[model samples]
Target: MKKFTITRILMLLGLFLISSGIHSTNKESIFDNIFTVMERTSSAGNLPGIIDNAGANRGAGFNGRYVFVASRQSGDYVYYWDVTNPDAPVQELNISGIGGGTFTLADLTAIGNHVFASNMVMPGIFKIYHWNGIGAQPSVLIEYDSGTARLGDAFTVMGDPDDFAMIIVSQHGGKSFYVWAMENGELNFDEPLVVTIDDLPANANFSRVTLPDGEDEFPVVSGPAGVFVLGEDEDIILTIEQSFFPGWPMYVNIFAYEGGRYFAFMHVKDNPAANVMYVLDITEGEDVLEALQILKNGTFAAKVLHSHDMGSIANGNASVSMDVVIDSFGNLWLMGFAAGNGFVVQRIGDAGPDGLLLPFMETFDGEGEDTPDTWLPEGWISFTLDDDGEEFNWYWSPGPSANPNGQMRSQSAYQDDGTWYVLNPDNWLVTPQIYMSEISGDEIIELSFKIGTGAQTPGFK
Candidate 1:
């Protein structure tokens, strides 16, 4: 047997320690081989209109499925797509109601075999669908009667619809906070549960549901531009710490349901121009519940010279904007304009808020700006797979800049399958390229990407 010197053994141990840290990041790498591409395949076919916020219902245990707002040309209704098989997903249902008037609604959620959706328009409405579980056809149930004032624009349905305390959050005039619930499919309109706040409107630029309250709690908050949930059933209520303050932040809020009390987190920042994210803690007066935070990255569109504008459009429409998406793993993925430079993804770890972290991430130019050169970026990102903790597979989405030939390469330590793949789209397409690989476990790892500018392409290879 070959022996190692003392120095060599120490080096091996050092490397082992570093690898251990990487393993600690994830117990089992969820992304083994499943890939999601963000192509501009909007079923609605319309760019998202100006709205504070919208999202699919989480109550419907349909995690890992694509549920987003969609509209039809024939009539106004929200559409749901069974995107589990993303490569060839099929529309499962067309949700509509009386008169079939078009609605600007959020996506649907699944509860057992039932799905729920909401329309935040005035006189907001909610639609329920029952799935037999055998087929994709979703049977429409009678709309839940939300006894809210006819001053709706930005609202959301909280809690499971099948439950007795199915609630709806209604904001009228950006000041009034109304909570309504349906019992036996009938709405109790006369008993208007109002949340009183000092000075603010009925609606603001942003809102969200953090918790679903119990039978007695009716807590809520409204402010110039912040909100948070107070409590839920026996869950802790979040109290506003005097130390926690919002200094002219754009839009931030928290919502929760606890012990008949609806907690709202509202950060009142005095400076209108100051933009920052504030963190809040939820507790039951004494016992700390959980750590929650609201980050606001508002954008201000600026007018550039006609020549510069044209150049920007020609060079891939670089206006410098940012957006955030919370992934299945509860990771907040932030992308877009970076300072006076390009763009990057801001990664946040599962730790307390005080120790905020920021890395150089990445920087790119107009590398994969156009078709034929828009699938992968050069030295942009690399992916790998872990099988039984023994061998790993690695691959990189190829870019024209890295390999002008526009190709991708993949390799595995255990398998010798020399296969390289490429998928391309023409024009200013804005869909992420997805890739999948199989490991020892039954689960497959997936990678979803939106590559922008650099010496590489902009999609998956």
Candidate 2:
């Protein structure tokens, strides 16, 4: 017999036992449902006349009931709109005379009542302008001359303006980025910490960085190569490959809704049909690194909950700003800029209910007739790293006579036209999200499954 190996998975069962502790209520994740609430094209003429300039609108910021957009041309101005009614955003304020000179404005970020904007006055000099309110005059908060480094491609600020905050900025053509800290609402302009990321691509323009809410350790960076999740020590922990994006990832943001967290990004170049935005649920892992690893390597596309295409928008230089409002209910909103196109707004709906209930089971017996041989179980995802695309790593199989029900098996070896080939598969089988919140304190959770290998032979290793 030609020796080979076949790994079989019989069934997966989750058994739950009742505990005496009280069952706490859980809020649903907002990323589960997403819908576009409003989108304004540049041709709509609803924005200021300066917005019509090519590659003008760049960065976006959200503070209270107002949304701020920065334009780079005509006159370096920041425009504010009253989005109390998101559908009808009334243009309100036009901030001009920033830096007291004509410079190219790049990006804008806001936290609470404070808004900050960046401008690259020249190849080696940049300034970060700050404003306390809509009526306040902007001032140069941090001015730096890097000699030869192109500064202020994109940046973000996190935390409260009246309290502590941190700002992250990217060098347009350099291998490193810069960070500054705020102590008691004052920026530390003496010296900014410079971090050089290894393996960062050369000449990668339009780089953007963002730190997750309440997370001061990990900062997610996006560039032409891909999206990298940096550890507290500035080491690259996880990377979402560029192949997963429709174009170069221009912006990335992490937001928390209810008790769950999500990752969102937009491409620098828009697809022919529209500019796309992707969101992945990263709530399972204990921390951001583990959650991203699970989403990138393990669960794969199973956790990608949303991908919205804003129609025919030209994202000259894309940017995304997220905010939440709570009145009688919680509302999560995303404000984005489509360079040549106008502003786009989207809302993520509540996740309705939590994930699957306890005592769940999957037998892999429901193979559809359309693909009887390679059918996958519902809610189960399978992916392979093989570039050939000719073979699947896992498939449905009819078991032996003694166990004829069905089985999920991996492809280890096969023969084609009398030529025997040994297969090495890099693949993953990911289960759907399971809600474990019901388990009370000190309660033990158990995972059990049966696995066996078919075709045992001495020659097979």
For all candidates in order, the CA lDDT equals 0.31, 0.57
TM-score of each: 0.36, 0.62
Top TM-score prediction, candidate number: 2
Against the hidden true structure, what lDDT does model 2 obtain?
Answer: 0.57
| Residue lDDT tens for model 2, 92-134 | 3435556532245877877777888888643655778888877
> How good is model 1 by TM-score?
0.36
What TM-score number comes out for model 2?
Answer: 0.62
Cα-based lDDT at residue 155, candidate 1: 39
> Where does model 1 exceed 4 Å of error?
1-64, 72-74, 90-92, 96-113, 119-152, 162-165, 182-206, 212-224, 228-461
